[model samples]
Target: MENRGAKPENVEIGLGKESFGVTNLQDHNIHTEPELGLDIMRHSAAHLLAAAVLELWPDAKFGIGPTIRDGFYYDFDLSFSLTPDLLEQIEKKMKELQKQRLPYEQSEVPIDEAIALMEEAGQSYKTELLHDLKTKGTTAVVKGLDDPNVFKTGMETVTLYRLGNFVDLCRGPHMEHSAQTGFFKLTSVSGAYWRGDEKNKQLQRIYGTSFETKADLKEYLARKEEAKKRDHRCLGEELKIFTFSEEIGAGLPLWLPNGTIIRHELEKLAMEEERKDGYQRVATPHLTKADLYYRSGHLPYYREDMYEPINIEGQEYFLKPMNCPHHHHIYSAEPRSYRDLPVRLAEYGTVYRFEQSGSLNGILRTRGFVQNDAHIYCTEDQAKDEFLRVMQLHERFYRLFGIKNFYMRLSLPDMDRLNKFVDDSESWTKALKIIKAAMEESGLPYVEAAGEAAFYGPKVDFQIESVMGTEYTMSTNQLDFLAAKRFNLEYVGSDGQKHPVYVIHRAPLGSHERFIAFLLEHYAGKMPVWLAPEQVSIIPIAERNYEYAKKIHDLLFSADVPTAFGGVRVQVNHSNESMQKRIRAATMKKIPYMLVVGDREQESGSVSVRTRSGVDLKSMPVEAFLERITKELKTRQDLPVE
Candidate 1:
């Protein structure tokens, strides 16, 4: 598929396939080259994975296998739980099949024949898939919107791929032979619901990665190992940043004291920045009447993510999943004129979403979290400037956090699937044009994505790469043209007529929980001096130096660093453990600086400074040490870890 050792030819990489009585392939193919991409190789790798699984467990009924970002996975209803040892055995089997040079051949037949083939193989999932394809078109059936009663006749031919004795229902342009599947390795396995429905049976999903070359695979594995070490769930506990409790239920994080400090620091920074940007702070209730959500159209569009409603005094109330609708009410509470355009409302509001437990990953995703949210209500003429300002605000925060590798994703609607988005083509067009103009004016790197916009409008989502090269979606700034009409939001223009205003929804800092999670993994627990919960640890060498340590700690605890909201955080370690052990404990907590106070330091009024990275700054006066750390905190600089 990668064409590593083969010449190019017209391979139908873009043309439609003759399958399921479907005439003419769809034009959604974005690529038209014979040089198939790595995704093609990865897709074949999934088939190989399924083939190996079937070899080990003959009765294993497999589900669909798809290519993810850098890898592939196949779901199987196995008779036994999969383990790391089993993964090795399956991998060995895949290599054996590869050596056999089994050719991948495609076959086309009627739907009933395909169904019979799956029935003989005892693949209920594949049989069910065939039934759906027979009744619904390719798109609706794949998305699980099939209606068995509404079957379409006269077009029942389907396609399948065969590898030796293993035949699978697939629309594939796989490698010519199994040997073409280059370097691959099974990474891990997890439980996934059949078709991602929690009500359905849970199946074993095996994950793996493949590359065109061994070196590429090796490099990817190394990066993956680095990510494993920096995983927020593990690092959060090891560093005592945060933890989850069984008593508190799943998908909820209990922020420890150190984690609280990080959240507070982030909140203070956001508040200061928003204040300078002319944003007025506001607060709203956590839950409101269900009628409000119905009015906002969230009930129809986002009901799945919301928790069940609470019946209060014969009325139903729901937890707020977002702050947009509430802020709209705030805007409508009072009359406004042309002079009052661009109403900037900011809040650190806590919102709730019923995220599936299996998808939860520590604080990166949770049930309840506070969002650093804001909405700008401005006139049509000021919408462009307001959007540009929001982009600039995001850049400022990114620069402050040393997030250098990021790009904006322009998300727009798909006209083909208008059911998912607002049925207002005029608004969609205007919103897309305005956001694109703002992005172009800013000269920031960005890429376009289709069918990923909010239900009501287009948006720009920020995708950031951590220092470890792991990328994630960070935050978004959306332009809404429908909400004003939905909420009857209006302002008096200079002509004294009521005119609708545009709304710009933005959450530059996203949520405190997720942002702190990103910051934790991004820094590898070595937070900047300004954000470190315990900035300096005073480790006295002996009992006599305890008093001196306390004095130095009190000095730092009281001194306020410039540009920092609070005083420097310093703790004196008067533990009975050995001096080196105390220093090591402090380092393990990721304290930026450890000040060793002893006989020489007590007499000279100086401290022996050691960094968490084990750098010995030698002996310096206590005042000098204070000045150095103060500068670091004032500048919000990262202490050298290497």
Candidate 2:
């Protein structure tokens, strides 16, 4: 250990530093590579930020600062509030320190001594963490929401990284010096609860991002600005699609009339597709007896996400978190044979969950949402084919929506975390093999992750990126070997013996709420002709054109002959507002078409069409316009009206 000057008790003024030599760096592989080093640099930037904050406000206390998806955030329990001005000041201080090229000196101290050092410095949170590490091991500290990799179990000493005058408890693979953190910009600040619990103190979190090059940082900032403009919460309100009320509660979205229309179009498409795929739609009650969940193993494994049970008629009922249990009961209601195997049960089921308020984001993460869910109970022999069929169905839908940048993530269980999954190792192995075979047979790109599987089995989550490059899990498909045994779902085999059926749970569209949110951002609220709530809006140039506009509206409305895409919703704007104002209103609503009727148009029996994209499809006969739009609707293509 190199003693820079400070004593061991305080570990300040850069003293008693442990050696992180070339051998240790090689063994641990501290990130010094290209793109792989971005996270390490960002994490080091977080420490630099903390050191700057302490320089400005010596009394400030900080919690853990971790690297999130594209950035890093540090939480501070400060006596004063942080603002944009303060962020700039902190950035200036960080630059001053960076110019010095201060080395990230390392030190290791006994757990008790570390606690004493934190206590002397008045960092109660750090003290608490050190005590937790000493008493319950690193696993227990991880359960308290700290990073699991930050400490090792049964270790008597903890590593601390010192950046100048500031010291932090961390098991680090950070950049060598402050200058190596690359170009960074402080983005924003928000309030966050310590350990993600609402009961804990609310700490002000400062968010920022780092990039390897100035051009990369500039490009990221540009994309971030575009993302802000395309934020779903803002667009949802501007489009009048959805709203939330305090009385209705958080994460429970209230869809407006226009939003309902959009949902109807999506549901119509789903029904048509499922019908062609030979799926039998089933409906189940929103509430079910708690015993059913226990039998399905959801009560024990997913209790935290589920709502509390409701007692009625001396029986406990739970708002169903999923429809699999109900569908199982339906399958067992009638006896089945091998010939009757491979029952595909589909449902647009509305399920309820008690999502944490902090995690809720617009309609994306909601308490009440309807899933485009289905279950295929098939024999082992037919399992691969059925799974491939589901994958094909997903591909078909994605192709229709022009969603090309999506991939599957195979989530497998970690034996170390066996408590989170079922104890049936044999079943787990078989299910994993089946899913792997089906995925490989599809010849699609996929990545595997450990400890992310479902409680009963392994699953493939379809991760999709929006136009702004933000990725999320849009759909999921799981192969379950335990559900059959748990629910006693069986089919008689060719040998006249009852055999447990293999179950595949899939949700291609995920939920209307989340999918709609994605669509709002993906399309920038300019929905395609087929999915637009008001497909056409007729605006009269003057009062004389009113009659002609009404005639055009009626014609288009009636021409919406019952099809799977449903009716082409058309409206006639007869309000006293100016024609341009009406046109602007329709444009703001993202209506696919604006048909302008004037004396010349009326006399010629034509309508002047203007698209939401500012394309003027000059005068055309009403019949010709309808024919063109009808074809677009039928095809369900995002053919922007030109």
Candidate 3:
């Protein structure tokens, strides 16, 4: 049984009123039927997990166990610490419980009676939560709230899921029995604070995912294995692309020589592309006055992610966490005419944000990173076309990199939750319509996310699910009329009247680091010819043929094909090692091509080509081989046969 919320409607009026809030509360009724098959199975599996845990650890106190995207996690307060071995044991016990085919019995209980039962069972955590709920008067709030009400005033009766002697406080629509949860795996264990508040006591979080079939579980595990092989951190280390140093801080990555080559290449491509698209590049300081962020409203909503301010001459300055505020200042830098109305400012700017230590996973999520950021200042009439152009750019970049599985997300404000949205509903509605029209005209698949829009305006977020079943927002194209107004950015219209220019904030490739990481996994580290660090490696048969191999390396390197020389001495010991061993070493590096030079080839003024797949081409003229490689590099070919 899937627990779903009400689908939001396209309300006719603008979302401008302060009283306007999120719609579709009726859709998420607990009594409603489930829409997603996997959701119900996963929720039921959580109950099985609780049952297994209770059988093993009789005193284990349970916290919230809910189904999340791709998985479910249950928090437990235990006398003994849980470990990976214990997770395996729990999985074993869960399988046993599944064999029993126990039924899930859901029961509704009053707040007072539930507290007494939990207290009798020595569930201190649940009892404490019950007391806190009563102290905060949540029961009265839930009881008083109506279906259309966005916020509840008092708590209502709570539901509990009972499996034999084990019971958990949950609002669940679980499957009928544990046997219905066909395939499951316990993935990881971590620490999580109660209620997501850092001040609260941390609880042990066990994360596991469930599926409807063993085949589905196998496929999921296979994808995870593929993801592991393609992990950017592992690839980066093996390729000597980048590294992190203790001295350089936790979130900062130090790019090595080969890694810098790829980084600079990507930046060069972005600079030329954006320049051709009529963007004027500009550089900004890494740190700026705190007032700048305050004016941009980032201080009000996102200050927690920002670093502590530095006091410079009694004035506070902060390392910028975003490039928009600085670019806004650039827009306000000088007086502008109507002809300069569509001013596009672009930057490969690096910004800093304080990500939680647990959240940081290599360069994918870093504290300091560069963004392929650009802001287009245009008239309101041009907003639609401008947004479409940004979307086009995103498509062009992704297409060039062969990224096909992605969708656009139209994020709009939830007017019902007025506190979560920016003040003006009319502007949001207008911007939403413009973005929606642009997306529709472009023939792109998109879904609207209520309450997910930026504070200043609505946005279209490009989303992709990774091999690990984790979803990531890859790129964004946002429409911002409010930021223009807030920054007082204006241009004289044809009628000689000052009008605020609309802003289209777009980033196609996102950040170089993140894009490369995704590409690394997408291609499984076998990068396309043009992007590979070492496209070709020339291997000499013996020490005697080193000179000829050097000549070939120089020829390939001069042609701008990234090539390296591997001497026989590096791998050969006397006559014991086979040529196949040396070739396998080169193949392990995922080098696209390997040219094996020997006395026969040197005498013929030609080279023997061994593609990464071990296909050998007889001695060919130097110019002929060079042309083939040059063509492959230019076309960004990945296939060895090509």
- The list of candidate 3 runs beyond 4 A from truth reads 1-40, 46-68, 71-97, 104-176, 185-208, 415-433, 465-470, 492-499, 560-579, 613-619, 637-642
lDDT for 375 in candidate 1 is 87
- Per-residue lDDT of candidate 3, residues 147-238 (tens digit): 34222333445677788678877667888888888699999989988767789888898999987778978987787777778878998898
lDDT of 1 at 143: 38
lDDT against the true structure, each candidate: 0.79, 0.80, 0.73
Displacement of residue 265 (Cα, Å) in model 1 is: 0.9
Off by over 4 Å in 2: 1-36, 47-68, 73-97, 100-174, 191-205, 412-433, 450-457, 492-497, 561-566, 640-642
lDDT of 1 at 166: 81
TM-score, cand. 2 vs. native: 0.80
Cα-based lDDT at residue 171, candidate 2: 78
lDDT of 2: 0.80
TM-score winner = 2
**Candidate 2: residue pairs that collide:** none
Model 1, span 221-264: residue lDDT tens: 99888778887888899888888999999988998988888888
Q: TM-score for candidate 1, please give it.
A: 0.79
lDDT of 2 at 70: 75
